[model samples]
Target: MILVTGATGRIGSEAVRLLAGRDLPTRALVRDTSRVPKDGAWSGVEVAVGDFDRPHTLDQAMRGVGTLLLISPSVPGQEIAVIDSAVRQGVQHVVKITNHKATPDSPVDRRRDHARIEAHLRASGLRYTLLGPNLLMQNLFAVAPMIKQTHGFVMSAGEGRFGMVDARDVSASAAAVAAAPAGHVGRTYLLTGPELITYADVAAELTHALGQEIEYRRITPEQHREAMVQAGLPEPVAASNAQVFGLIAEGDAAWLSDDVASLTGTSPRGLRAFVTDHVDAFR
Candidate 1:
C-alpha cells in the first residue's frame, strides 16, 4: 500500500485521486477521518488518521506501506521528525514535496528543513525522490479579489519572472515518480510551468480573462508585508512571504526547467489558462 500524508491538501488530494483511479491500494493519512469529506470516487481507498506532531501514531498509518507520498506540512520544523519516523517504520520508498528552489544549501528556513529531511532519507538507505515544485498558480487566489475589487493587481516581484506550475501537474509528476523504478531515488526534480511570466503579465491575463482593465502595481517589500498583514496573515508569515518575493525580485525565480514535462509526459499549464479557469475567483 502507498501511504499519503496531508491527503486532504491540494497536491496530496490530487495524488490520492490519481492513485485511487488506478485501483492502487492507498492509505490516506488525515488528521481527522471525519474531516475528510466523503468522495465516492475514492471509495476504494483506505483512511488512516495520523498527525506529524505526534510521531508515535505514524507506525499504524505506515504499516505495510511500500511507498509514501510525504506531503510536507505547511508548519515549519515538522517535516524532518516526521520523515525520520516514517523511515523507521520501514517505508522503502519516499516521494517528498519540497519547494522549487530547495537546494542542499538553500537559505530559506523551509528549504533547509527539506534538505535535512532529504539527508535523513538518504542516510536511512531508502529510495527517495525529492519533488521541488515552483510557486503554485493557485497563489493567484490572493490577487483575485484585488482584480475584482479595484481592477488592479499588486506585488513586489517588480518584473521578476516565475515558472509557477499548477498543483495538478505537480501531483501528476509525483504520481509518476511513485510508480517508477528505483532509479528515481536520490533524484530531485525542479517542476515548473511551461511559460515564464511576471506579475504584470499575470495582470494582463486577468484583464483579458475578466474583460476589465486590471493593472499591476509594484510595491516595496515592506508594503507587500503590510498588505499581507492587512489580509490577516501573522506578522512573521507575512514578512517571510514578502521576503520570498524580494528573493524573486532579485532574479532568484527566473529560471525554467523541463522536469515537469519530462516526468508527466506533457507540458504544464500556463498562467493564462490558470487565470482563465479561475477568473471567477477574481470576479
Candidate 2:
C-alpha cells in the first residue's frame, strides 16, 4: 500500500486520483477528515487522519504501507519527524515532492528546508525518489483578482523565464513513481513544462485567452513583498515568496527538463495550454 500525505492538497489529491484510477491500494493522510472528498474519484481512497506535527498519528498512518508519497508541510522542520516515522514503520520506498531550488545556499527558506529534508531522507536507508517540480502554472491563480480587475498582474520576476509546469503532471509523475519504485529509487527528477516562459509572456497568453490586453508589471522585490503582505499573506511567507521571485529574476529557475514526460509518458503542458485551460479564473 502507498500512503499519500497532504492528500487534500493540489498535488496529493491528483496523485490519489491517478493511483485509484489504476486500482492501486492507496491511503491518504489528511489532518481533517472533512477535507477528504466523499465521492467521485476519491471513493476508493482510504482516508487516514494524520498530522506531521503529531508523530503518533503519523505512525498510525504508515501502518501496512509499503511505500510513501511524502508531501512536506510548509513548516520547515515538520518533514524530518514524518520521515523518521515512515522509517520506523518500515516503509520500503518514499517518493518525495520537493522544491526545485532546494540547496544549502538557496535564497528561499522553503528551498533550504526541502534541502535539509532531502539530506535526511538520503541517509535514512529507505529507497527514495525525489521530484523537484519547477514553478507551477497554478500559482498564477493567486493573482486572479488583480487580473480580473485591471487586466494585469504585478510580480518581481523581471524578464527571467521559468519552465512553469502543471501541478497535475507533477502528481501523475508521483503516481508513476509510487506504482513502480524499483527503477525510480535513488533518482532525482527535475520536472518542467515543454517551454520556458516569462511573466510578460504569460500576460500575452492570458490576453489571448481572456480576449483582453493583460499587462505584466515588473516591480522590485521589496514592492512585491509589500504587495503580498497587503494581500493578507503573513510577513515571513510574503518575504520568502518575494525572495523566490528574486531568484527567478536572477535566472535561477530559467531551465526546462523532459523528466515529466519521461516519467509520466506524456509531454508536459505548455503555458498557452495552461492559460486556455484556466481562462475562467482570469475572466
Candidate 3:
C-alpha cells in the first residue's frame, strides 16, 4: 500500500491521480475527502482522513502502508510528525518533494526549513528518494491577475535565468518515483525544464500565448517586498519571498538537469508549453 500526504495539494493531487488504479493500492491522506478529485484519476484509490498536526491520524493513515509520498507544506513539524509516524508504523520507503538543494543558508526560507527535515529523515534510516524541483511555472499564476489587468507583472528576478519547471511535470516525476521506489532509494533528483529562462523570456512567451504585449517589470527586492506587503501578504512571508527572488537575480537557479525526463521518460515541460496551456490565466 502507498500513502500520499498533502494529497489535495498541487503536486500531490496530480501524483494521486497518476498513481490511481495502479496495481499497488494507493491511498490519499486528506483532511477532507471531498477535496479529492471526484474524477476518473481518483478511481479505486482509498481516502484516509489525516492531518500532519495530529499524530494519531498520521498513524492511522500509515496503517499497512509500505511506501509513502510525503508532499506537504514546508512546515518542519508537519513533515517531522509524519516521518516519526512512518518510522513507528514500519513504512519501508518515502518519496519526498523537497527543495532543489536544501542548504542551511538557502535564501529560500522554505528550503532552509527543508534542510532541517532532510537531516531528520536521513537520520530516521527510512529508504527515501528526494525530488527537488526548481521554480514552478505555476507560481506565475500569482501574478496572473496583474498580467491580465495591466499587461505586465513586477518581479525581483532581474535578468537572471532559471530553469522553471511546470508543476505538472514535477508531479509526474514524483509519481514515477513513488510508483516504483526501490531503485530510487537515497537518490536526489533535481527536476527542471529543458532550458534556463529569464522573466523576460516568460513575458515573451506570455505575449505570444495571449496575443497581447506583456511586460516584465524588474524591481528591487525591497520594492517587491513592499508591494507584497501592501497587497496583504504578512511581512515575514513577503520578505522571505523577496529574498528568494533576489537569489534568482544573483543567478541562483540558473541550472538545468535531465532528471525529470530520466525519471518520467518524458521531456519536462518548458516555459512556452506552460504559458500556452495557461494563457487564459494571463488573458
Q: Rate the local accuracy (lDDT) of all candidates.
A: 0.82, 0.91, 0.91
Model 2 weakest 10-residue run by lDDT: 72-81
| TM-score for each of the candidates | 0.93, 0.97, 0.97
lDDT of 1 by residue, 1-283 (tens): 8888888888888888888887888889999877565757567889988888887788788888889998956454466666677777887888989877655677676666666666666787778888988889988887777777788978998888888889989988888888763769788899889888888888788878878888999998899999999999989888888888999888887878899889878898898878777778888
List the lowest-lDDT window of 10 residues for candidate 3.
Answer: 16-25
Candidate 2 wrong stretches, greater than 4 Å: none
Taking the candidates one at a time, how many backbone clashes does each contain? 0, 0, 0
Residue 206, candidate 1: Cα error in Å is: 0.9
Residue 269 lDDT in candidate 3: 86
lDDT of 3 by residue, 1-283 (tens): 8899988998888888888845568999999977878667788889999899999999999999999999998799999999999999999999998998798887677888999999999999999999899999899999999998899999999999999999899988988888889999999999999999999999998988888899999999999999999999999999988998999999999999999999999999888888878777788
Q: RMSD in angstroms, all models?
A: 1.8, 1.1, 1.1
Clashes of 1: 0
Local distance difference test, candidate 3 = 0.91
* Model 2 TM-score, 2 decimals: 0.97
